[model samples]
Target: MTVDRSMIRVKAMLIAPNEDTSAHAVTLNVPTAENPEGYHRLIGGSVEFGETHREAVRREVHEELGAAVEDLELLATIENIFHIDEVLGHEIVFLYSGRLDPLPAEAGATLTESDGSVVPVVWRSVKDDADPLPLYPTGTQDWVSAALTRQRP
Candidate 1:
C-alpha cells in the first residue's frame, strides 16, 4: 500500500530585539497576494534550494530585515498539522533566534499585505503573559515565550 503525503516544508521563526537588545521581542511579517498568504511570514522563510538551515537563516535575515544577524541558533519545531483553507499541509516550522546587531527601525520594515500591499512592520515585546497579535501562528506566542526561557542547546 502507498501512502499519499505532502512533503514537509521548512519554516523559519526569526527574532530581533530592539536596538539596545533592550528586551526579548519578536515580529511577524504580513503576507501579500504575489506570495502565498501563509508564506510571507516575518523575517524568515524556507530552507530554499540547496541551502543549509544556517544559511537560510542568514539569507532570510538580510532579505527581510536588511541587516546582519549573529548567534543564530535553532529553537523549536512545533509540528502544526493543520490547513489554512482546504489545503493539506504541515508546518515543520524551524524556529531560530538571533541578534540583529543594528536592528532596523519599525518604519523601515516592509511586509507584503494580504492585498498585495507593502506594509510597515513592528516589534512586539514577548515579555510576560500578554497575548501577541493575531499575526503570529497559533501556539506560537506561548512557544516563543518558552523558547526564550529554555536553556540553549
Candidate 2:
C-alpha cells in the first residue's frame, strides 16, 4: 500500500499568549477575491515526517516568530475540510495553547513565510464578539471560549 501525501495534511498551530490571556497571537490574512472579508488564524505550520505535533508546534513558533513557547498544552484536534480561494483543502489540525517569550508588540508583528510571503500577526481578543476577523481551522474559538471561561471566577 502506498500513502498519498497530498491527500491530506497535518498542521501544528499555537494559541500563544503574551502576558495576558485576554488576547492570543494570530496571523492576519488580507482580503482576497474569494474571501473579501479576510480572516485570522493561529500561528503555526506543517508537521514534518518523523516529528510529533508538539515538536512541530515549537519549531514553527521559533521559526516564524523567533520566540519560544512555554506552558504548552494541547487544546484541540480538529479535522477541517474547506475551500480557500475556491480551492478545496483538508487538514488535521493540532492546536496548542502556550505563552510566548519576549512578548510581541501590542500593535502586531510581521511573519515571513518559508515561501517568502509576508503576513501580519496581531493579538486578537479571545472573545468572539471583540475580534475583527474570523478565526479559521473552524473550532478554534470554542477552545478560546472555554479557556476564557475557566480563567474567570
Candidate 3:
C-alpha cells in the first residue's frame, strides 16, 4: 500500500448537541455531480496548507456555522476511501466532539460556501431509525451514537 498526498484530505467534524442532547447539528450538502441528491454531513471543511488539524476544525466551524466551539476532544480518526463520480479519493478524517457555545434555534440555519452555494444546517434527531437524508462519510451515524453514549453520565 502506498500513500498519495494529493488524494489525502483532512476534515474536522463537530459532534454538537443541543441542551438535552436530543439532536445534533449537521449540514445538508448541496447536490454535486457525484451525488445528485446530496446528503447530510458534519459541518467542516478540508484542511488548508500550513494549518494544523485543530486549527482547521476551529476555522472551519466558524466559517461554516458562524460560531465557536469549545472542549474539542479528538474522538476518532477515520481512513475514508471512496469513489466520487468514478474518481478514487481518500481522506484522513479527524473527528472532534464538542459543544456549541450558543446552540442555534431548532429551525437551524443556512451557510454559504466560498463558491456562493447555500447549505442548509439543521438539527436532526440522532435516535431516528431511518434518516430521510443520507449521512455522508458512510459510518458517521454509528460513530455519533457511540460517542454520545460515552459522553453520557
Candidate 4:
C-alpha cells in the first residue's frame, strides 16, 4: 500500500525570554469569528520549503513579532499528534531557545497576522501556577520548565 504523508506539517517554535529573563514571551490567541475560545501559544510558524529550522524561526519571528532573534539553540523536537475539531493532525515541531535584543517592554507588543488579526505578545512567568492560561502544542510546559531550570544559577 502507498503511504500518504500529506498530513504531516513541520513547525518551528521559539522560546524567548524577557529582558530581565524573568519570563518568556507568548502570544495570546485572539478569538475570531472562525475560532472562539482562543488560547495562548509560542511565537513561530511552519517551516517553508527549502528553509532550515533556524531560518524559519528567524523569519517567522520577524513576520509575526517584528523582531530579530539571535543565538538560536535547539532545545526540543516534539512529535505532536492530536485532533482538532475531530480532524487528525500531526506536526513535527522544532523548539529553539534564543535571545532578542532590545526586548519588548513589560507591556508587551502587538503582532498583526496576514489575515489582519491582532495578537498580543506578552511576557508571563513560566512558573506561575495561579494564572490559568492554556498554552498549546501539548508538551510545551515541560520544555519551558526544563529550559528555565537550565538557565538558573
Residue 68 of model 4: what lDDT? Answer: 93
lDDT of candidate 3 at residue 66, scale 0 to 100: 80
Over 4 Å off, model 3: 1-6, 32-36, 151-153
Each candidate structure's TM-score, on Cα atoms with residue i matched to residue i, is: 0.65, 0.89, 0.83, 0.82
Which lDDT tens digits does candidate 2 get at residues 21-117?
7888889998856568899878998899999999999998888878898888887788988777666778999988888886778885787777778
Name the Cα RMSD for model 3.
4.5
| Better by TM-score, candidate 3 or 2 | 2
Candidate 2 accuracy as TM-score: 0.89
Question: CA lDDT of each candidate?
Answer: 0.58, 0.81, 0.75, 0.77
Q: For candidate 4, what is the TM-score? A: 0.82
Better of 2 and 4 by lDDT: 2
Q: Which stretches of candidate 1 lie over 4 Å from their true place?
A: 1-7, 19-42, 85-88, 111-117, 128-132, 147-153
Angstrom error of the Cα, residue 68, model 1: value is 1.1
Task: List clash counts for every candidate, in order.
Answer: 1, 0, 0, 0
lDDT for model 3, please: 0.75
Give the better candidate number (3 or 4) by TM-score: 3
Clashing pairs in 3: none
For 1-153, candidate 1 gives per-residue lDDT tens digits of: 222337877766665556544344345444433234433234666677788777887877676557788878777765756554345667667777778756766555664422445545666655534433443444565555555565543
* lDDT, candidate 3, 30-94, per-residue tens: 66667778778787777889998889888888876688898788887777787655567788888
C-alpha positional error of residue 2 in candidate 4 after TM-score superposition, expressed in Å: 28
